[model samples]
Target chain A: MTATARRVVVTGLGMTTPLGGDVRSSWEAALAGTSGAASITDSWIDEIELPITFAAQAAVKAVDVLTRQETKRLDPSAQFSVIAAREAWKDAGAPEVDKVRLGSVVGTGIGGIWTLLTAYDTLRQRGARRVLPLTVPMLMANSSTAAVSLEFGAGAGAHTPVSACASGAEAIAYGLEMIRSGRADIVIAGGTEAAIHPLPIASFAAMHAMSTRNEDPQRASRPFDTQRDGFVLGEGAGMLVLEAEEHARARGARIHAELLGAGLSADAHHIAAPEPAGLGVSRAIGDALRDADTTAADVVHLNAHATSTPVGDIAEDHGLRLALGDDLEHIAVSATKSMTGHLLGAAGAVESIFTILALRDRLAPPTINVDDIDPDISVDVVRKDPRPLPAEGQLVGLNNAFGFGGHNSSLVFRSV
Target chain B: MASEQEILSGLAEIVNEETGLPTDSVQADKSFTDDLDIDSLSMMTIVVNAEEKFSVRIPDEDVKNLRTVGDAVAYISQAQG
Candidate 1:
């Protein structure tokens, strides 16, 4: 069979999120409609006056799970990736595939910001002689990808797609392409982010892109609700082991879902705001469905990129209607960001895991805190409690992720 | 000026902090690369930290010559004097 014809399947899954430290815990919290956002307890928040005083910090600190050497050498971003990758690798039964046939792809929105800023401070205060030698390696955008590749001895290639919020989804798309194009037989793909620092929060606040509902952190991220002012900042990582369908079957690996196709597009409209009409979003969703050789009628669930911003949510709503048409009403759309908040670079990878789980569990998790659903949203959103899907059927789902730079990505998967 | 024994103990503490190798294991006779298993990056960290601790300058060119824990302690002691 041509490599293009080779099928890719998800064999393992892992993540560390504000909701929980691992995949199982996070998924459980998501299903229970628990919100991860809370008041900022970091001492740095007191040092600087930031408008937004709350965020969805990771439930378990990455440093607590990593070794002292690893924590010292890697920044928080790479540390999260390593932690998730470790769980994912072990979940995949720690396959013994050749190092040459394996690849690692990790995406991060802002890489090692903590390291860069701290190193710069050290340079000005303590002089150049005192700067740590490993600062550059830790601060680079590709640090997470390099660390993952080195950890697993992935020789095929190590890639980092830096497309802001869409970065994580782009990484998974690139991994799918790598396996299809015969570059690698197995790929570790995911997105990680550790940008909850004061500078980023302040920057987002300047753009009015983040919600400043400090009094009610849990209800701040209410996707498709009229009350949502903007997105909420969250930090964590999610990883998946994608192996060729035949390779997985040969090893008797447990399959989670079959990754059918991926679609990526750009708006070319504005830098920060999404294409107001969501033409780009529609194109991405259309392309993903077509690439999967499926139609809107086959899709049953949609894990939307609804970051709870008024404009973004309305635009995505329009995009879903344009692409899915009347079938949008049948899809149990869920915006788990209402619970986990927006994980930025890691959002896509984490949501993709949720989509797969929704298919596997035969239920769609609810979009919490939607006290008043916006009238503009025409689709049937799973709210209040988990919604059940058909227990027996060839179920298909889509996960959408959009970035600030007009980047849009849609991934399609099928129940195995 | 730090005595040889004092330098040895201080250097051991530095090595222990950097590599998690116990201070007791960082003997005067132990080679940094062989016995202590310190890599180049870690060696640089230890060198810079040791320089600050002893208030001495162990130039980069002189680092390769300091093969063992004893060599580093001796260099720091001499540079202090």
Candidate 2:
């Protein structure tokens, strides 16, 4: 509300996912309830003992999209980030802004785990001399934004904000604040993650946090279902070009949505679980609405961070009910991770993309595999069919992300 | 995996790869952007390649002057010094 927080707008978007390689295809696949998940076929799978042998792997591998040398130099996380960022940059018409006036903020839940695990093995077997010199930069948490900054010459600032699952949404929030604070005119913001390898899969599986619907990978991530076990691991990146509303208008850029507001809260109840009381989560939603200078009725569609886990899906439901109150039933709720799986840090960004699309297109995508709802939770779940938006006023969509460290983040995107 | 002269040419390859600067346009004394129009990414590639080819660490301060082939060869000479 202060002069430091200017109005930020979303101008361009890009995504790479299991549903499809491009934004159009991914959106269609998501709405149609097509799954991006499948059984792991890579030789890397043989090395780890995971409870679930399937995940929502990217429809297009980074190596398939990038040059072989590019794949060799950058980690999977960086590769996915580059692919999505290039799409967004190209989508933004490759604006020639001042390098000092352009900034980048990309966050990931897990950075270059592939590189870390691989390099560690190389050090043990092949000796330190054989390891690539670029390993450190490739594996660092800020690698995506760093690569993006170098590409676009964004010298003003390049930062990475990590908050577990909320990382991507937080990155977008940071970008909005940066422009509002007069630090930069334009920023490329998003999140990416590629932790589908044996190490992470085994680790997550060991924690009993992954869905074990191996035979039916497509139906594995059944969010909002009474029988829902856990989320399926996913790997991909989602990126957006954020610019000041005035700057976007001056450049005549295509406005996808307006970044209305963002709210952050800490549960402080558990390290890897949500507060059963849903107080902190409710506060985060309320905070974002207040930050956007809007009310509950403004948000027509809600992108819930329901990762199919029993506790997570219901906790978000309780939080949504508390935040929306009587208007909760009218807000179409879509559990995207049911189709795309859990993207970890990239989850918020990709889901934010989903939210933006719902606003721009006026259609809320469905939360697939709702075989048996509790019947007790009164929230209206969008399932099987995408719901149409109202014709009159501005459309606002909310994205929620809760992380392992008791981090809760909410972002509001309004149709421009 | 490559020779030192090859490393210089390989260094040139990095410049060309990232910046698309012409081979003939590249000069030893020329500043990367001032003369050849090399971008920051190209410079990063050059460092990555130099470390790979020569197995030497081109300190950040040393890379500041590495604009041309001569600069790279000289840096390698000094780093290898």
Candidate 3:
């Protein structure tokens, strides 16, 4: 941490999640403990005979929010990105910052899967010339970043971090550094995912990474519970307008929360499974607290990356216990993925937004479907209803996101 | 073979569908790029749809010669003949 490093604060937030189309509605549904998971009724599920038929589809389709021309040009992932970015830009009061001083970073675990698969299908069925001209651009991993960058004329840089589920948190972290490093005054950073198609669902299910509780889709995602099977696949996008503290103050922008710092690490233990002892997870958390110049004692809330997977939840518990030590008991831990399902790449960003809201409102959202809590989870898990945070002073919260290939990312947020 | 007026009407529909231009506004003298604001990608889409509708092939090289709707209509009529 350098003395001259600029402070980064969140000025705006936008999202289109399974809970709702916008941030407020989604937050409200989260507070009410509504489950976004439902049985996917798309005919392709039946055609493919997928083992997992349920997923958390976006509450609002992108076609409903975007123009016909925009939809024709962009893939589903890019469509979600553009929709969220539009809201976030408007939420930031549509700042008139110089185009060269602005930037965008949108991360995705899988980019334009629908586009790629569909284009291939078109080629196979209708021949080569029938494929759309924009297929390559739409299927690229950086398409969302490019779309948002073009939307706002962000010239400082357009970056896409593809670290699986950790992608979103990494993007937010990158935006924080962009401001701190004096590269950009404001950066729109987050993640979007539209991988609810048949192929992805089948692939994840083949790895036994998804729950098969098709009868009760709402209760399928049971984090920190004994009966938990696996994660429920989800689709959505989350975005945040991150600005330098000085730039925000100079422009009189309304501040949402302060992004104190981020810590990222790799496990190198396994490709898909987490390290049993959670050494990498602890290091990331410890580094984040250290980077934020704060101790575990100041932290009062946590938005855990409990994807409801059987071993994954236990591994994260071990990691949290190792990092926070005795202070872990004091933090009100909430696994909002029980409501939003596992948003994959967007999970970290959406969970970050929930953490910010928790700090702002002094209330932590609940972790639903924990009928029988796991005894191994020693942390204080907020369940059923929203829990109130400390009312007296500045509160700090942490959001963790771990991805496949041993990627781990943790972000710290402090109330203003 | 379709009449010249029918070819123009069919081409107008394809152009309208591809670029969202009004069919009535797709005049014979209107330039696909300057007048209709259709870019090259959209022109390709329109060409493909026109090929399917009129049952005539418009090669990639000849697409450049289709500067105006009148040129496209004339080309399709001759190709069909």
Candidate 4:
């Protein structure tokens, strides 16, 4: 039957987030509308002299749990990826695979910025003789994928897509293609980022895109709220193990959900802000639905790319209207970053975990701190208390993430 | 504190650290280009990073023939000599 089109299924999942270190805890925090954003506190915070101060760092630093050697060699971003991937690998019961048939696709918006910056400091202070030899490998964007591939001995292929904020979603899309094209039977896939440094924070702040709510870090990122100012920066990673449906079923692995579809597009409009009308956003959502062989009516929930920015939220609503039409009224949009802060490149993958859980539990997480909904956004955004969905036959969910560089991506997942 | 044998061991570690693989997985006597799993760009990165770490300048011609750990150690020893 033409190999059944090489259906893709998610067999394992893992995450390290500002809310919590694992998927269950992160989802729980999301449902509770708890914010993970806070002030800068790392050792390097003093060096960057930045204006935008707060961020949503991982709830548990990878160093606390990972081996000393691992932390020494890998960048903070790669460490998060490897940590999450290891959990996912073990969660998948560490399946046996032909090394040639296993693959990886991980993405980072900015690779090794922390490593590069830190090493530059070392060079200025201690001279080149003492510069760490591990700096280059630690800083490369593809290092996370390479690190994970080595861990699993995945020789099929290792891929990294640098699509800014849409990277995580694009990585998943790339993983889906690997299965569809029969390049790999299984893939370790996700995005990781640790760009909460002061330089980037100040840069985004200079553009007036960061919230000045330093007093209340938790309430700083208020997406779609009338009082919303801007997003808080965050760091972390989310990884998933996607395998061919037949392969996963053959091995009797538990299927978290089906990898229904993924769509990617570029706005080609702006370097930072999304197109005023969200032209690419609509196209991305529409393309994903078509790719999944599904429709707007099937999508009960949406994990929006609402980074608490005033204009971006409105643009997304416009895109939703164009893509889903009348179904927009019934769809429940969850502004997850309203509490998690913007994880930047890691946002899509981190938020996708919440979207998948919404499908699994038949409930939509509330958008907290949204004291007043934006008049510009027309759709029904779940607010206040946790939202419960009516028991349904099958549930479909959509996740949207648009990056600074006009990258737009949408992923659709449904109960298998 | 760094003996000849210890220096040779440290030289071996440079390759292992760069590639994230065990040294036993690759041979000391073999050419890094012909024998190791690393690519050319990675090899270049290894050369640059190792040169800086050792505080020793490695001429481009010497870098070309100095493929394995043994070659690197012998070259360094001769330069120091």
Candidate 5:
């Protein structure tokens, strides 16, 4: 850490998840133990034979929120990014910052799959001349970040980190770095994914990464449960407006929580599987704590990346235990994917928002559908209902996000 | 044979669907770029949809000449003839 490092704080949050269209509604739904999973309803679902028939679709449609002109120019993922960015900007009271000093970092696992595949289909069925002119711009992975950058005229730099599931958290972590390094006064950072299409579902099903509980959609994402099979694919966006603490205070903006620090690591083990011993994950947790200048004892709640996969859940548990040792038992571990499903690229940012809310309200949202807790999970899992935090003291929480290609990221948040 | 009114109304529906403008506002005299705020990409979409709906090939060379609803209607009428 540098002596001149500036403090970064979260001033605004916006999300459109399967649970709800915004942060408050999603947080409320999470606390109330609501499940957002359902069977696939697209007409194309019948054309493709997929082993998994269910997923967690966004609570609000992007078409309903954005104008036709906006939607026409932007892909679905970019559309979600723009919508979340606008909401977050508004939530931050539209701070008057120089365009040159503002930045944006939005991430995604797969960028504009719908546009790419549809353009290919159009070319094959119709002709080359029938392809849309904006196809390349829309299909690019950086489209979401570019759209966000254009939205706020963020010229500091528009960065897009594609770390699979950890992309969202990694983006937030990058935002923190940008602010601390004095590169930007404010940054719009988050993740957005709209890959509910048939191809992605088919691919995940082929990899056995998605749940096959077609008969019971809501109860399918049972993270840390003995009967858990796999994660349910979800689509949405999560965004946060991060500004320098001094800048936020100068503008009299309401600080939601302090973004203490972030940790990043990679497992050199497998392309898509987690390290059984969670060696890399533990290192990330320790690094995050150290970066935040916090101790294991400060962490009272954890928004875990427990995607309900049999192997992934156990690995995260082992990772937490290794990182915190005896302190892990005291933390209230909440598997928000139990409700929001696996939001892929948006998981980390959405879960980070949930973690920040958990610290602010001093309430831990429940991990729904944990009918029988897995004996392998040694931590105290908050299930069924929301749990209250310790009444009087400052609290810190951790949000862990691990992704394919061995990427692991952990963000630490402190109560305001 | 598709009449001029048919072509105009058909193009209006495509413009309305793409740009979310009122069908009534898509007059034959209104310029797609100046009046309807249609950009290059949207103009491409309009041309592609018009070609498919009217069963005519609108070459890339002719797209630059299309500026208003009446222009597209006349072009498609001549191509179909």
Candidate 6:
């Protein structure tokens, strides 16, 4: 650890997920072992003949939360980011930091796909003159970060880390660096994704990466289960108010957890598939523990990146075993995606919020729909019911998020 | 030729849907930006929706001339001719 390094902590969290609209509702629904997946009902579902019919849509619609003017100007992804960021900023008691020292780092895997496609359709059907002037700005991948920056008047910097699924966690990691390097005093960091449209669904189905369990949408995302087929695509956003420890303390903010540190690595094996040996994933886990100045023995809970894919779940199991060694048996590993579905870019941020809530509440949320546990998964999977944390000690938890491009990220959080 | 009342009502509906402003509040002489709080981007949406509905091509240069609901309604009605 560097002598000049500053301590970063999480002051507030906000999330709009498939499970629920906000952090409190989502956390409660996750603990209750509920599945958010449902059959697609949009008109395009039948028009495209998509093999995968169901997805985990956000429990609350963006239009319901945001004004019509806001929704019209921003894409769905940016809308989600703005909604979650507003909640997080308010939750932090609206810190009175200088605009020059505030920052925003929101990431997305596929930004503004809906807007891009809709604009193209408008041009084709109507004419070139019909295309909206704001199309380019709305369709940019960095639009979410820009929207958040504008909302908070952040002047330090606005960053978007496009690491596929790991983008959200990478954004948080970047926020931690911003504070540690004296670049910013407080940063609103997280991710948002709103690609539940037909094109993305058809593409994922074509790649054989989505579950085809149309008849049983609720039980489809059975991560680590023998009957698991593939992941269900979901959309939403999650944000965290990350501040330097001294700054948060001075402001008397309610600190949820310590943003210990993050570890990142890439498999470089496949563009869409994980490394079969879990080498990169294991390295990220080990690096996170080291960065947090903790060891495997201190870790008690893990929010695994078990996307309900056949190969992905096993690879994560192998990574956990390799990194934790004997301690893997004691950690209460939960696959919250079983309930929330795979949020793609937002997965890491939402799961990190779940990990923080687990430590704060001293309870590990249940991983539902494990009718038959896979024999290869050796860790104790918290299934059917929520599990209590170690009754007495300061709890440490790890949240792992890996993306299609072999981007592996691990964050370590200690209870405040 | 489209009637002035039809143009005004159609434009008002589009503006109300885009800005979430009440339909009754979209008076003909009221300025879009000042009365409805519709910004430039939303103004573009209003123009596009109006063009599609009335089958009239309102050029970019003419957009700046459309400050009030009455101006947009008159422009679309005259363009239809």
Q: What ranges in model 3 sit over 4 Å off?
A: B1-17
The true-structure Cα RMSD of candidate 6 reads: 1.9
lDDT score at residue B21, model 3, on the 0-100 scale: 71
lDDT for each candidate structure:
0.93, 0.85, 0.92, 0.85, 0.93, 0.93
Model number with the top DockQ: 1
**Residue-level lDDT tens digits of model 6 in A1-416:** 47679999999899999988999999999999999999988788888887888999999999999887789889999999998999899999999999999999998999999999999998899778888878999999999999999999999999999999999999999999999999999999999999999999889999989899999999999999999999999999999999999999998999999989899999999999999878999999999999999999999999999999999999999988899999987899999999999998899999999999999999999999999999999888999999999988789999999998899999999997
Chain B TM-score for all candidates, comma-separated: 0.97, 0.68, 0.97, 0.73, 0.96, 0.94
Could you give me the TM-score of model 4 versus the true structure?
A: 0.85
Give DockQ for candidates 1 onward, in order: 0.64, 0.11, 0.44, 0.10, 0.56, 0.59
Clashing pairs in 3: none
Task: Name the lDDT value of residue B21 in candidate 2.
Answer: 65
lDDT of 3: 0.92
Query: Can you tell me which runs of candidate 6 are displaced by over 4 Å?
Result: B20-39, B67-70
Docking quality class, candidate 2: incorrect
Count of backbone collisions in candidate 4: 0
Q: Give lDDT tens digits, candidate 2, residues A267-353.
A: 999888889868888999999999998999877899999999978877888888888899885788898998999999889999999
Residue A378 Cα positional deviation in candidate 3, in Å, after optimal superposition? 1.7
Which DockQ value does candidate 6 get? 0.59
The true-versus-predicted C-alpha distance at residue A101 of model 2, in Å, is 1.4
Per-residue CA lDDT of model 1 for A240-281, tens digit only, reads 999989999999999999999998999999999999888999
State TM-scores per candidate: 0.97, 0.86, 0.97, 0.85, 0.96, 0.95
lDDT score for candidate 5 against the true structure:
0.93
> Deviation in angstroms for B32 in model 3?
2.3
Model 2 misplaced regions, further than 4 Å? A3-5, B1-81
lDDT of prediction 4 = 0.85
Off by over 4 Å in 1: A1-4, B1-3
Clashing pairs in 5: none
Sorting all predicted structures by DockQ, with the top scorer first, yields: 1, 6, 5, 3, 2, 4
